[model samples]
Target: MTEETHLNPTQPVNQQIYRILRRDIVHCLIPPGTPLSEKEVSLRFDVSRQPVREAFIKLAENGLIQIRPQRGSYVNKISLNQVRSGGFVREAIERAVVRRAAILVTDAQLYQLEQNLNQQRTAIDRHQLNDFFQLDDDFHQILCDIAQCRLAWETIENIKAAMDRVRFMSLDHVTPHEMLLEQHWAIFRALEKHDEQLADETMHQHLAEISASVLLIRQENRDWFTEEQ
Candidate 1:
């Protein structure tokens, strides 16, 4: 594993604040149903209420948080319906992408994939969970690109914004990091051999893990979830 690194030189102050708060919400730092106030964020970040409001708007737009006017904002709660819907959509798109990648992946793309896998492996070995998580995202992006399915990936990204809350929770319980690594390797092997079935299966299995993880998170953190309301 490699040492953890951070994303710096990001967007301007408001966007950067939005990104930070959004991630914290998704990662459960804010927790579901916890009230968030414009005045609180403004005080904490030593900024005016306007940037905090802007950040809240971005989060609300992405379904990560809710702003109920005078009632203030809170982290968005989980919905089982959303998870099931996301799983179905994500699984179908990724299966097709993996199959296409098996046929159309170029040597250069394969090389890049190998590099990404190596980065992930290093992150895992070093126990750099944050870097590992980010690389996991990169690994999937590269596969989707190799398959010429950027549009599908863009769609997934929007769904994933909501799904990430459960994903981060499941990340806490998962001991199968090696299984994830192996799945990526399996996809690479299929691409090398131009084996469509194998590639499709590999991606299918890889993507399916998210569903299982979400269930585990909901079970383990039941308090964070409402009664499907």
Candidate 2:
């Protein structure tokens, strides 16, 4: 694996390493089951073993790596169960969030949502996949913020790691940016009308799209998934 040389120097070395490694793992640049050595990583990043080890610990805590005392650390295979559980929690929480947002969203927030959608369109047209992904996240987060349930997004963040890995994997192939944009537009329209039921239903259908992609991804990348999948 190539070292990330552009990490912010002002941050703690461990945090910088952790973020780089986490991004690599989630994006499948560092494939599942690949061994990660503290010594090698330290050398690669021109950092010391201490920070590398600390980064490994954080990655393990996030379920992105498995650390075996004697065998060393390796990237964790994607857990289907974890993805399903996270999806369930996200769907439940986000459905409620959108329902509330539909009722409570202000004109200012609605304009912000429109701007986000416009940026999303630009990302799609330019084929900037990563930008699209970040904008997609921002779109949902705005809904949570408008709902006065910003903390609920923090909850989703914790459980959605596996789902995010799946999303990154699916981005280049299965899931089209336009499709996701359409779903977001649908949810926005429902919210525009302040129709809670329609917003709830739209959110449900939006999330279900991931479930469909998961099956295809699991089949194609069998080695990247745990046996439970």
Candidate 3:
């Protein structure tokens, strides 16, 4: 809830609003438990309340916010159960994705993965957390593409919101970027050699980091998480 930001005139207003708001939520820009006013968000984006309402509905569906009819809407606190469950599903899906990628990946696709790793390293060195986060996602997305299963990435995206918040927090606190980078390298090497088992195992270890780091993250940012665990 700050000054108005420009929006793409070509894109659907509601989707633009949703993506921006989603990114803000995931990055903790609008920290958990913060009240969200439809009018304020509309003013911030220089849009009508209808689109903002639509975005809010989508956010609610994603469990990033709670909209109470008689009361008001607020960003939902991270649910530990949701994060752990999401991580579990993500690991199961991505382990399979990496294994398939190992069998199907081409030299060109492997080079793309290598480039992403390079960008990740540069982002870390420059302390560009946002850039590194995007690179990290792109690395996984590329794997799904190589596996010829775009729907797999789509499925992960839907369930990964809560997990993403903790991931952002972990990156800022306990988790080291270098550690994640090494894991990516391990996965990439397995894919390069077409080793399905190694690819699956490395991907499991990589995705499991979120679960492993969540307890420490919740301890550090206690207010950001729900007590309902």
Q: How well is each residue in 67-161 modelled by candidate 3, as lDDT tens digits? A: 99978899999999889888888898999999999999999999999999999999999999999999999999999999999999999988899
Model 2 spans > 4 angstroms off: 1-3, 9-13, 43-51
Tell me which of candidates 2 and 3 scores higher on lDDT. Answer: 3
Measured with C-alpha atoms, the lDDT of residue 88 in candidate 1 is: 90
lDDT of 2 by residue, 15-73 (tens): 88987888788878889889999998888888879999999998887788999999999
The candidate maximizing lDDT is 3
List TM-scores for all candidates, in order.
Answer: 0.84, 0.89, 0.96
Clashes of 3: 0
For residues 1-229, could you state the per-residue lDDT of candidate 1 as single tens digits? Answer: 1111233456466776777787777766777788888887777777788877888887776677778876878877886767777779888888888898889988999999999899989988888877877788888888789878788877887777667777767664563667788888988898999999988887887878887787667777788764342
Candidate 1 — what's its lDDT?
0.77
What's the distance in Å from true for residue 107, model 1? 1.3
lDDT of 2: 0.89
How displaced is residue 30 in candidate 2, in Å? 0.6
**Worst-scoring 10-residue span by lDDT in model 2:** 1-10
